[model samples]
Target: MRSDTAALTTITLPEIRLRVRDAHKLRGYFGELFREHSPLLHNHYEDGTFRQQYPLVQYKVLDGTPTLVGLGEGAALLVELFLRIRELDIDGRHYPVQAKHIEHRTEAIGPVAGLRRYRFETLWMPLNQDNHRQYQTQSAAEQQAQLTRILTNNMLALLKAVGAYASDMPLLLVHLLPGEPVVTQFKNQSMLGFMGEFVANIALPDGVGLGKSVARGFGAVRRVD
Candidate 1:
């Protein structure tokens, strides 16, 4: 049983309303605003190279409000820039910010004793190009099993990103609730995304995004229990 702690910071623009589809635009706005910290903000190098690691800072539009979540070092960076964010410029339109709220927490990243239920507040994309093709050919049960395995892997990746490597890999099971997946557009291409709940024997911080395109806020989860 190994556990590690990381700083988590969430900044929400409560008074500002933005379309969920403009999450990437919010990322772009902040990334350019803080170019010196572009790597931490957008996971891009100054030379325009992509950082091949988990994004510590993620942008999201949850419930029609622009939100920023940062973990570990990124948390500190977000705190540093929180006071500087006064407005948003999206698609040549200006939206002035009025009231903002920020929360900080020290979250545990490790295995848990009991299964915990989590709901995907945002769409969860568990398939890539290769798996997308294979996922369509599988039976319903097989698809669920495949998604379970991928989710377990996703948990491991998140733990590794926070430097919390479990000495003994915990038993991870993702029992997806009965629901139909939604087809969403990502990068102009249609993708299958799931918006439901699952039970896992691990604890994750709220506002943390998982799966692909997490930096753009695709897979945000919150514990229901």
Candidate 2:
């Protein structure tokens, strides 16, 4: 594997924060806004500039308020494109929202921590492996192996997304909180396993996400330690 051990020039990412009113149950809110304003978002990108290297525009609802996190330096442009709205229509529900910006906290974020250890917790949704049903019929040891594979796949994707392809990343230890299965909005008309209360201890960067539907805030991970 190749590695870029050179120091990365720090880039300050600005989050497009928003406060929503009268929306207690916002399952697919983020997906809706981007879908509704696809053109407005698309206009900002030059041809072939918007590759999915960790979602240049990451969307999430924090503290019951929706936010669009600009992963790139040019991400703040999204705020200008949508901030003029008094309200946004997400998943057929009109939510009154206030939009603004704030710098993402990055002081303690890194792929390798001081102790080579990190603890991650889900913000809104859970860490879904998409292998929930397989676990039901497996032995305890087999289940653990399956779970680790799922988490490892997730972490590997994150590392690749950020161009971190150094060797030995696969040896990293990962533990996941048992996710309960429930119906989610992704399939719309079908019920599937939706992970809840996901937590992990792995050597990875802070603020990176895992599992399925990360673009719509399904598996949000943050540093807890």
Candidate 3:
């Protein structure tokens, strides 16, 4: 196992009541406002090409409040811009920011002795276009197995992006707690999303996102146990 440390910072506009669906708008607003800072803010290059890297700064709406999470270098960027975020201008509507809460932490990323349970505070999108068709044909048990594999792969990618890579890491288990997967819209296309808790022998910090469209707050998880 490779020992790695990640710096994480979370900023929440506690007084703002933004709908979860408008998270992309938040991304758009900040991406444009701070376009000169770095491409990680919006995951786009100056020439309009997509940066094929893990998104370090992610936008999310947790519990009806606008939340922004930054990891690694992204954490530093958020800290630098923390004080300047005074309000949000979404579609010409001015929403004044009343109060904000920020939390910063450095977490170790590696295998843990025991599994940690985490709940999906936001929807977890596990399938992409190619796999979506296959997922539709699988049995319930097979579907669960496939999703577990995808979740594990997602974790590996996240760890690698954060400078930790463990080829012999312990198995990760995803238990879909008693509910049917919900269909949601992502980038104007319908997609399936899961809402449940997962257990993994990895030390993932709270507010880290997983799976697809995470930059838009698709798979936000918080430690529940």
- Candidate of highest lDDT: 1
Model 1 C-alpha lDDT per residue in residues 1-225, reported as the tens digit of each score: 555788999999998888887888999999888988648897889788998888999999999989999998889899989899999999999988888899988998778777889999988888888999999999999988888888888888888888876667766656777268789887788889988888887889988988998988888999998
How many steric clashes between backbone atoms does each model show?
A: 0, 0, 0
In candidate 1, list every pair of residues with a backbone clash. none
Which candidate wins on TM-score? Answer: 1
Instruction: Summarize candidate 2's per-residue lDDT along 30-103 as a digit string, tens digits.
Output: 33445444422322343534345444445555555555444333244454454453565654656555444444
TM-score list, all predictions = 0.95, 0.58, 0.93
Q: Pairing residues by index, what is the TM-score of model 2?
A: 0.58
Q: Give candidate 3 regions above 4 Å deviation.
A: 1-3, 168-178
Cα misplacement distance, residue 117 of candidate 3 (Å): 0.7
The sequence of per-residue lDDT tens digits that candidate 3 reaches over residues 1-225 is 444789999999997888888888899898888999999899999999998877999999888889999999899999999998988998999988878888988988757777788888889898999999999999988888888889888888888888777667665555555257899988789999988888878888888889998888888888898
**RMSD of candidates 1 onward, in order:** 1.4, 6.7, 1.8
Model 2 spans with C-alpha error above 4 angstroms: 1-54, 73-86, 91-99, 104-110, 113-133, 168-170, 179-185, 189-207
State the weakest 10-residue window (summed lDDT) of model 1: 170-179
User: Sorted on TM-score, highest at the top, how do the candidates line up?
Assistant: 1, 3, 2
What is the alpha-carbon RMSD of candidate 2 to the true structure?
A: 6.7
